[model samples]
Target: MKIELIYPRWKKLEGQTTFHLPPHGPVVMAAALPPGVELDFLDENVDPRDALAACEGCDLVCISMMLTSQVKRGWALADQLRARGLRVLFGGIASMLHAEETLAHADALFLGEVEGRLGAVLEDLAHGRLQKVYNFMQAHPPIELVGPARRSILRDELYHHKGVRMVDLFHASRGCRFKCYPCAVAYLGGRSFRPRPMARVAEELAAIPNGRLFVVDNSLAQDKEWEKELFRTMIPFKKTWCSHTIEDDDEVLALAAQAGAWYVYQAVFDTSDFIRQRVKRYHDHGIAVEGTVLLGLDDQTEDSIRRLIDFLLEIDLDLAEFTVLTPFPHTKCRDDLRKQKRILSDDWDRYTAGEVVFQPKHMSPARLQELYHLAWETFYRDEPQSMKMMKLLQRAVARERALGTYRGRRRDLVRQSFGRELTDEERGV
Candidate 1:
């Protein structure tokens, strides 16, 4: 029997970055399917046409989705596949928490981690005993049970969009240890870090093309020693990479820089002495750090927002992304917002981090929305600072493209270059 795994596109939001890469959830789910099962993976974000066309012959279709903005698109895809007379199964962070709503459109719903329950689900389907719901209670499954994702299905041509050559896509671990109130990782993976073996991770990285790699892990610093070791191994490859980091550890930061990490996506939730120290480490390492700020946290007052902006400017971060805090389903913040009657919008489509979902403690919902727009306008709107960022990014793009050509890498010369500073004028920052 043939099985198709589909990932839906997110709703378009102004000023927000649209990810044209494959979704990791469906890739991991494809990895876990029973051996010999005729499985195909489709990420509509990158391969929409092939995905829609592949829906024809599949015996069963599974959709992995998020709760925020992808709800409508996900359901629409499910509805389409069902119209083709294929049994539809839905799962992911969003579907896990909102099973009843998802079940309205899908024939079966799997909750929690897909790796643990995938085999049984496939067997049940083969024997004509499919159930409406399957839940995996364990938070972390054994590594042996987690099979390698079938990423080979992704073609080299898919990476060559507009000009960006795609490189390796990897997940070093599962679960986040932080209890950040608004983050879904804390709720879904629990407050514990479960990492894959460093040796296996290194092997995987070595197997991928020797270019810029993107680590989709929650945060590289979650396991300091493991991250350090990984960086040490990566240094030899001299391949630029990007990953999320909470704060800068002096040793790790240095190692990451030497290992060819061009950019670090750091989360600056609040400004403090600790944050200052971390930012200094990035500056000292000559690494371009992109500071991502959450503007609509409960504690963010008008003064605090202005202060945060000033801090970001003071640090001269290469790039920054300011988003309103969203309380996704299954997160503590969502529950709290529901109880406090702070959620101003029930429309799941607007739940993407770009939208203001709840009224802030210090500001009304409308004021919060205005503040969100103001933050972007103040930072990225044809200002000198924004212009500087754009020039930096343009230079970096040219440099990376040159390097790609010299190296004779078949990868498209997309903006995969690191250290290019983007200005507000160029990016409309």
Candidate 2:
């Protein structure tokens, strides 16, 4: 059987540098498909026309929706495909979060992790006994069954920017132990932290052909020992990476630095000394810090929001991403806002973190929206995100050079220029 795996595109955050990092969910799902099935993976972000053409000879069309913003488009794609007599399957984080609504648009909806389970779903498809839903949300397979992602399905050339390859996405674990208010991960992947065995993680890492990666675990801080071991396991690979928060302990941060941690996205909710120290700790370990600051929280007054923006500048974060709080389905934030009848919109498209979909306790929704843009403008005004990103790239390149994995042509050009004496014009004389 043949399947066309489609990762529907969504609107990126406004004012952010637009780049597509090869997605992890689709490639991982590709690995879980039973052998002998021809797979064509299409990321619609690159080209929607090519994804549309894949429907020609495919036996099934599978849509993977990772973000809430992507669900509307995913539903539309499924509706279009199913109209032409092709079967459609929905899976990934967004699918689980919006299962009831998604089910209406799909022939079969596969919920939860696909490892050691998707084969049966395929068997059902082969026998004309496909069920309406394959719900595996609570039945996470043993972590050992997780294998290397089928990254070969991706068109490597299409995932680059300015001739530099984008980082390939990888994961060493699933689920988050903490149930943060605005996050749906706990409901989607459970509150228990589920880590893949070290051996399996090592296997996948070794098999990945990219020299850089985005370690997409929900949060590496869940288990200290596992987090440290994961870094140790990764040290020999000499792969530079960035990820969400890591354990704040000194030893864990040191191990991560040794393991080629390029930077990390850490939450900077307040201007407290503890938060300041946490950013400093990561920096002291030679890891750059990217602040993921969310505005419009119940505790944040307009004055406090302005204070938080100034605090970000004071902390000297390498970069900062500003997003308004969004109430995604199944998250605690959604429940509370729904109860208060303050949710202004149920349109999934506006659920993109960049937009204000609910009333803020301390300010009007319009005021909250204004502050959101203000946060971005204020934080990026001095250094600008692109320049900051270039600095991070320089760090990654230096790290790669130290590890003997540097392969960029620009590095060779820089070395040659330094070897020769510069003329007057070149020296800006």
Cα lDDT listed for each candidate: 0.72, 0.90
How accurate locally is residue 171 in candidate 2, as Cα lDDT from 0 to 100? 94
* Residues 300-350 of candidate 1: C-alpha lDDT, one tens digit per residue: 898889888888777767777888888788778888989998888878888
Off by over 4 Å in 2: 409-429
lDDT of 2 by residue, 126-165 (tens): 9999999998889998888999999999976667654677
Q: TM-score of model 1 relative to the true fold?
A: 0.86
TM-score, every prediction: 0.86, 0.94
lDDT of 2 at 41: 85
